[model samples]
Target: MSETSPAQRRPSGELEASVLAALWAADGPLSPAEVQSALGGRLARTTVTTILTRLHDKGAASRSRAGRGFAYSPIQDSAGLTARRMRSELDKQDDRNTALARFVSQLTSEDEQLLRTLLDAADDTPQRPGTGPQAAP
Candidate 1:
């Protein structure tokens, strides 16, 4: 059998990221065929469908029935996606304190300051609706 060309081979992680990017770029939910088209038609409809399904399972995307197929949309913006990725990685560590300490040690001074300010602001924020005690009807 002939070997796959470099252009024909992409890491599964990269393909998943590309699929998510396509969904995020769309103004509304897109069927797998639309997602394939958005990615320049390089991927098959089945592949796009599988990727979208996996993303939906991972909470990165949501899907709703459309015609005989399903339309997919990103559940979060890019920043939210990045945060989810970071949290997922952090969750994998058995030594979370050590991991966090090492991560903090690598931060740039500016980033360190920004993180401190953000944490401070978060501490001052009121509990969001439905999270705190609810008023009696």
Candidate 2:
């Protein structure tokens, strides 16, 4: 068999993840060429474009006219995206309460304290209409 190319050997979604990291690090929207450059040119310009288009389609990114092509920006910053991913995984659980209990049980003391502090602060904060964690679904 022919030797597998590094590109072919790359794990599924790795390229898209790298592309998303580049987008997240960027101060503003980036074109495919810029994204490719940001990734140290490991990916082809076409590949970056494909990832950006996929992100846009999935609502993880937004794009706008930048000359003949589009410039893309992540819809959420890194923290928001991480939280969204956590929520997505949590939503997939058949035993959500058990999953949450296990998750909380594994937290380090500091992390648990921080979570509590955040929760306390959130509770103390006034909620605006249709906003905040306390808002009705």
Candidate 3:
């Protein structure tokens, strides 16, 4: 049996990112077919649909019934997506404080200073309505 070449396959995360980018570029929500076309038709419609479905399950995207199929829209920008991933990873740890301390230790001096400033600002700011965690739908 012949093995599939890496070039012939996309990393799942990369495909998700591409789909998210297409959604972000679109002025309105896009169907899987539209997403596939926006991605230069490199991916199959089913593949695009599956990626969009996964993103929706992860709360990274939202979908609503449009005609016969669904139209998907990204709930978060790229930076928000990255932050979600980071938070997810941190949540997996039994010792979140230790994990965060290690992560902070790995950051550059500038990043550390920025983190300090952000933390200070966060301490002063009041939690705005609908800005923190929301109840699951």
TM-score of each: 0.83, 0.79, 0.85
Residue by residue across 1-137, what tens digits does model 2's lDDT show?
53357767978878788999999899999999999999998777877888899989977899999999999999998788889889999999999999999999999999999999999998898988889865767
Name the TM-score of candidate 1: 0.83
Model 1 agreement with the true structure over 1-137: per-residue lDDT tens digits: 43368788767699898998898898999999999999999887888889999999999998999999899999999999999999999999999999999999999999999999998897778977766445445
Which stretches of candidate 1 lie above 4 Å from their native place? 1-8, 128-137
Which runs in model 3 stand beyond 4 Å of their true positions? 1-8, 127-137
Q: Write the per-residue lDDT of candidate 3 for residues 66-123, one digit (tens) a residue.
A: 9999999999899998999999999999999999999999999999999999998987
Model 1: lDDT equals 0.90
Clashing pairs in 2: none
For candidate 3, the lDDT comes to 0.91
**Which lDDT value does model 1 have at 54?**
93
Q: Is candidate 2 or candidate 3 better by TM-score?
A: 3
TM-score winner: 3
lDDT of 2: 0.89
Question: Which residue pairs in model 3 clash with each other?
Answer: none
lDDT ranking of the models:
3, 1, 2
